[model samples]
Target: MKNTSSDIEEYLVNVPEERKEAFKKLIETISENLPSGFEQGKSSGMIAWQVPLETYPDGYHCTPGSPLPFLNLASQKNFIALYHMGIYADPELLDWFVSEFPKHSSRKLDMGKSCIRFKKVDDIPYELIGELVQKVSPQQWISLYEKLYKK
Candidate 1:
């Protein structure tokens, strides 16, 4: 269920009213913790936090036109998805999240390499997510992204 809306407000309008607050909270957590240079708006049909094209003109390796994504949040039919690039770029961060999240959250950790699925708001480990979001600065992410592409 990919919503084609490019505006964050338009995208949120597609989100069910009941889940809107949760989505906003997720946005807040990411915004509060994200590094100083990342921009927040819409990208990839969702609310994306990223290093703007002006900041890193090289963009994503997979999509040259798209900005280098740091985090993305979307409301789906059944759940909300938070895409955290930090964990994808750094294996140790993923390892720490997998081992530590469950200790603080009752919900089982549901995640892929970069996407963390939250079936309910409570399924989100907000504090841990914030910590993860803050682990890398925008400059750091560019370095990591560049390093990966070099290989």
Candidate 2:
């Protein structure tokens, strides 16, 4: 479900009790793996880690007043969602993830361009996810963003 909560804590509080621990674990993994200069906040009804607006005031394309989103974790109606911006920005990264995920995970990867859906907590490949999250630092992300879309 789309959360209207303004804070991460508040957002987590609204998650179903049975699913809260998994969500917390996801948050912990994200917190531990993210590179420097990413700030955690609420965006698009999900918990997001982004390049702070102070670092790049141009912010997101859709929401220029908001920070540029890097990763977003959301509890969707049917599954948990992890949006990794690195994969979206770099085609090689997405290809690698698709090729490598099945090698390491028993669960089928449910994904779009960048959104990975987890039907159960066990469906997550924590190590791979962490590695993917760590692939780009804030500065690198900004560079990639500008290179791809700064026209």
Model 1 CA RMSD to the hidden true structure, in angstroms: 1.4
Candidate 1 lands at a TM-score of: 0.92
lDDT, candidates in the order shown: 0.85, 0.89
Best by TM-score: 2
- Which residue runs does candidate 1 get wrong by more than 4 Å? none
* Sliding window of 10 residues with minimal summed lDDT for model 1: 142-151
Alpha carbon deviation, residue 38, candidate 1 (Å): 0.5
Worst 10 residues of 2 by lDDT: 120-129
Per-prediction TM-score, please? 0.92, 0.95
Total clashing residue pairs per candidate?
0, 0
lDDT of 1 by residue, 1-151 (tens): 5778969888888888878888888888989988799999887788999999999988887887778888889887788998888888888888988998878799888878888888877567778878888899999999988887644
